[model samples]
Target chain A: MTRVFAPLACLAMALFAAAPAVVANAPAEATMGLVQRIFYYHVPSAMLMFVSAVVCGTASAAYLFRRSAAADRLASAAGELVVVFGLIVLATGPLWARKAWGVWWDWDARLTSSLLLWLMFAAYLLVRRYGGPGSEKLAGAMALFGMANVPFVYVSVNYWRTLHPKTSVIMTLEPGMRSAFWFCVSAFALLYALLLALRLRLEERRAEAEALFLALDE
Target chain B: MRVAWAILRKDAAVEMRSREIVYTTVFFAASCVLVFAFALVREGRAMPDAAAAILWIAVAFSGTLGLGRTFERERYTDTLRALMLAPSDRPAVYVGKLLGMLVLLAIVEAALLPLIALFFAAPITASPLWLAALLAAGTLGFASVGTLFAAMLVRARSRDVLLPVLLYPITIPVIIAGVRGTAAILQPVPDEAMARFWAALLVFFDVVFVTLSLWTFEPLMTEQ
Candidate 1:
């Protein structure tokens, strides 16, 4: 089934992301100790990345099993969102990495893998465009296989030496830090949900345009 | 079995006699080396790993060229449709076609490896056996994806331009795994540390592409 329409998700996410406590009480450098404030966008962008991949994987599996056009649309929608989330990761990652790691860029495993993943998904987008009528099937297959890298990007931090910090929110966070972090988390998640919703709409328009062109040809 | 074998043998025989892929691929790879060499003359330290990356890049580019050429040959002059109509399960055709492509790529890679070593002045010796295997696996991974996609692109507007667009993006992970694996092995480190990571990646990727390509080929072929 088609997911909820884009406008609705965007509206809901906007409201949720803008709760007063998140924006007004955000731990500014003046108030909260340093390194405590980047949490606002960092975790949210990351959460969105995972959410996008999960959606991509779900739609891909649906398409493979059923081969329905609806499934293809969902997969495409999710794939498009992955690209969006990827851009978020890319923009926000370096900012945080530089602060956390003291360098603008490094060959840290997470950074490299994340960069590779962005390229991989970017490649996914290209593969779909390069594919012709029969490309949907190929795109579906790629979505599934490429999803493997999503987790690799996550766990890759642990695999090798990295400047990116280990996952520490759960293991050790003062309650105050946790509250601010959660605010950032909810805000970014809402932002992601909104963007994802809008992207899926664009995909529908593009798909509809393709169908129209094909019909006119006949 | 005989029917499939016939297709494989015919393909091999043609490649053997024409030597088109080998000649074109070797020339193309050498040209890449020379061009990149002149460009990176100041950065001589770019070395063999860089050479390896360039080597594989040329190999992938040339392999796609060959694949597109092969499909074009089938589309314009040969009997690809007739072969499909032949009494063979299509997966057999997939297997046979993939095998032929693999053999052709292997020949190109074998020739290119030492050249890469010589250019970079790095040893592509027996120590990097796993690295060599990783390169081979990565080639297969790209070939599998390219061969199937090339088949699809044959009917498109610009198959040659379109092939790399589709082929390389999907193959990025393979490139990462391949380059990383090769670099890891060539780093002169103990096998146990990074070996599992690269080997597992190569094996996992190889399995993924081979199986996915096989599964997708029938639908892609039937669509045309």
Candidate 2:
């Protein structure tokens, strides 16, 4: 536990330390003003959400084919991370939207797709928790489908061309803002790795306990 | 192909004898339209604008109900176990189920079209052939994914609820295409190009999901 917490604590500290630089050094957007600052946390959280979903999907594919406890555990952990970061995106998104778009919620393609992706994995976790005996395999299948939807979700913006900003907008940020963004991205990526490792350890311990229980029962 | 036909014939014969699923789904579709009419009438909204969206929502939900009951019948008869245990090609079984679902949903949609037309007083601007093509493509994509997920959910508890929760998120694109295509056909000035685009999207979704479902069905149904 200490081993896991020690590194996570350090990352948390670094994130806090970097938070000020992100706010102070990064130039505010000409349009959205102070609210644009949320972009740092919001974008990184969304990025990690996508990364976690991909990991979940790959690990799910692995579990589906091989039926390994390790793969299932990693997939399960990553699935939870998708929800975690997805919530951050979901929350920060509306706050930014309220400022930028003047509506707390818009049925824009990107926002709707993100919510759908989040719900898809939320359902995945539900199945794992309550689906009884073969839940792992069920959840694995869901993960694969969720992963498959990601590209479609990412592109739905182009397909519909609604209000949400396109990918090119991200590429056009000023250098300092761009670097600040990358720094936050790195910090959140580190956070995701730390959480995944800690979650996987918890899952392994639970598996060991269940195995011991079965042995004792026999 | 022969194996698929035999299963399809067997299910068709059984359905003909009982007509249980057909009646229930058709009734469900009607009820959905009625409920929507009542709800929307109270709100004094543009029912024509909502007509296409309402029709697809009814079909999607009722179709989900049919899929669950179809497998539940297999479970009651222990036929799922028998079929899984049998020495036969599994993808054939999937094809057979997919065919059965397609036929069933088509019937429900057939019943739904006139009801929507009457209730919303919306003119069907596109030709019948074009509308039928869009419906077929959309339902094909929907049932392909529905069949796979329903089969996977067969033994799980709360599968009735799980089916939709699991099914809807993945099938959103199909729903979007279906609604957009239907709207195009029902539009005041029908946009042939837009309708064709949505139809093409539906076809693309059907091809990808059907192929994936067939490849994965055997493994997913297997007890690991």
Candidate 3:
């Protein structure tokens, strides 16, 4: 019980402690000064969204290979979290896009692929819910396979000219931007770990609840 | 090879006797033809180039109709698993079924080609060689994926609606690439710089996907 809340409490504490340091070290914006903080939250959320999907895919493949009920449950956990965070990223991403690119979307390879990944995983979640009891095996295989689209999206920018800004991974941005970015990265990564751990506990509790009800009925 | 040939022959023979493939394919083709008529009614005469586009669509759609029907034949005969367990490699089953579909598509196209000429007044300048080459390349790509998809959806809840849902988006790129190559070879636009390159792309996509589907089909079918 306490295990679920511990990390989340720690995350809240960490973010509050780090926030002032990030603000003090932040650079003066030339224009639209306050709108830039979105960079911190949005970029890290998007990165963690990718991390969640890769985790889902890896867990799904493990589920397929071992046929373990534990692996299946873990895959489901990753899938549901990916959907929650992927949607958050999608929602906040447009805010960043609007500020940075002056439009909500530009059909940039990353944007298109991210939307596709969200939809595909959303479909997997839907299938898991709606599919009959025996459907897990088939649905799991499908989720694993459909992730091929992720790599395609990642590569599409390089393969073809696109409207989205190419990844600025070179790290030449000024120190203020760099500091905020790293702070946000650590903050969100902690938040993600906390949320995932909590979610997995809830899933286990739900399974226990189901078993209890079934026992009572029996 | 001989066993596959036998299966192909048997399916063809039944198709011939019942006139099933022809009737459905022609009916579907006729309805699509009506769509073309209504769409171009203001023009009053069908353009040859337009005729070519409509021609392939009729083939593709009617081919879907036949695929849905053929995949279930073993189910109706009470022998789907039995057929799979036959003393033949899984690829033989895939190839034989795909060939059956190709034959049906060819028949549908042949019926439509002349009708297209008669209905639209198209001069049919596309030489037989060009048309044959186009059909050969295009059909291989279509049949490979279409057969695998039909197999996938057979166990689904809504097989009919689901087949197209599962198949079309995957096949869209191939269809566009193919029709572009077909159009290029047929029209021979003199100023265009990359006609052959487009055709080459079609060949590449066809080889890649067909090989991919063939390798993947056995695991897909046999997987628990």
Candidate 4:
């Protein structure tokens, strides 16, 4: 784990450095013009946010049923990342909306569901933090519920008409922009992996130190 | 089934003795409506959709209060431990507790319905059966998740504050469906089709969350 950390960090940093150049080279969108550029960062961050949610939920279930410390730590790591990436999606979304939709925000299906999803995971982290002892189990239940809730939230909010672009837009993207989009996605994915690994290692160290202190006291 | 029945009976017997939770929850829900009325009603007329919104808000708020109190009783008596020790299924206990919550909230909503109609002029009785179905499915959805969280928080620190924080976000979909369905019924024309869609969504939500809660109940309630 220690040996691979430096290389992974370097690779992530390199990709992030190259991201701006690729995004700049992509052809500007026709109607929305330059403001559409936010999609490169916003969409990829949103994708990773959902990915982090799935990771957190799966790890939480493993921890609950198997009571594995490793899984619990992994869940904790993924839970925090969900919040981080969700912030990017939520923040950049409005900037683009403000330019394209003539409004800062709308209660459309995609936006509302993403906001609720973010809040649920935020609640997950809150439970784990302030719930005192035995909160891990409680937090695990929260993640599971949060996972099951995504579809319901989406469906209920989607009953009304939506103004946000459908996800199918990715399939029809022009050639240059398509490559740039995937480039940013891979960069974000690499960064997500690097951060998850770093957070997991930190949790492992904390657990080890706590054990050492307990042993010394004994 | 008998285990669940016994637990429900136990909760009912206790509530019947004092009527404490029922009374307080009803009053709390009423006050919530009154507060909203002050803000949304003017010149003796309520804002659009305010009735449906206030009704469900009152339900969610007072329901949280009731859930906390219900588990707090068990924690006070240390009977939760005894109940856990019993040779019965944990999910059955959850169902029993959930049934108790639904009953308490039902009474509150019953009282609230007339109050809302009088105050906001909502046509709550427009489609009686559809309204009832919406209320039932929405309440079940809310209570199903609430009961589990309340029970889990029984031993946690600052649970009173934490209960709403944890419950509201997860239960927002139920609230949305309930408010929307009730709003549809309260509309001048009473859009039964729209109400039916939200009702169906609420039922689906109930099925999913109730199943998930039942599955997680045993592990969550088990102390390490």
TM-score of each: 0.81, 0.95, 0.70, 0.98
| Ranking of all predicted structures according to lDDT, beginning with the best and ending with the worst | 4, 2, 1, 3
Clashes of each: 0, 0, 0, 0
| Model 4 ranges off by over 4 Å | none
A1-218 per-residue lDDT for model 4 (tens digits): 88998998898899989888899899999899999989999999999999999999999999989889999999999999999999999999999999999999999999999999999999999998999999898889889899999999899889865889999999999999999999999999989998999999999999999999999999
Instruction: Write down the worst ten-residue block by lDDT for model 1 chain B.
Output: B184-193
Best-performing candidate as measured by TM-score: 4
- Alpha-carbon runs more than 4 Å astray in model 3: A1-5, A9-108, A130-133, A149-161, A186-218, B1-6, B29-66, B105-143, B175-216
DockQ of each: 0.28, 0.66, 0.17, 0.84
Question: How accurate locally is residue A44 in candidate 1, as Cα lDDT from 0 to 100?
Answer: 67
Candidate 4 reference-contact recovery: 0.78
| TM-score, candidate 2, first chain | 0.92
lDDT of 4 by residue, B1-224 (tens): 88888999999999999999999999999999989999999998888999999999999999999999999999999999988899999998999899889989899989999999998998877899999999999999999999999999998997998889889999999999999999999999999889989999999999999999999999889988
TM-score for predicted model 2 compared with the true structure: 0.95
Which candidate order results from sorting by TM-score in descending order? Answer: 4, 2, 1, 3
lDDT scores of the candidates, listed in order: 0.69, 0.86, 0.68, 0.93
User: Can you write out model 1's per-residue Cα lDDT over A1-218, one digit (the tens) per residue?
Assistant: 14655566666566565754564564455433455455566566666776776777778767766666777777777777777777877787777666666767887776676666666667567667765556676666666666755554444334546666667754566666567667667666666666665666677788799999999999
Model 1 stretches astray by more than 4 angstroms: A1-36, A127-132, A151-160, A188-218, B1-4, B41-48, B126-132, B184-197
Candidate 2 backbone collisions, by pair: none
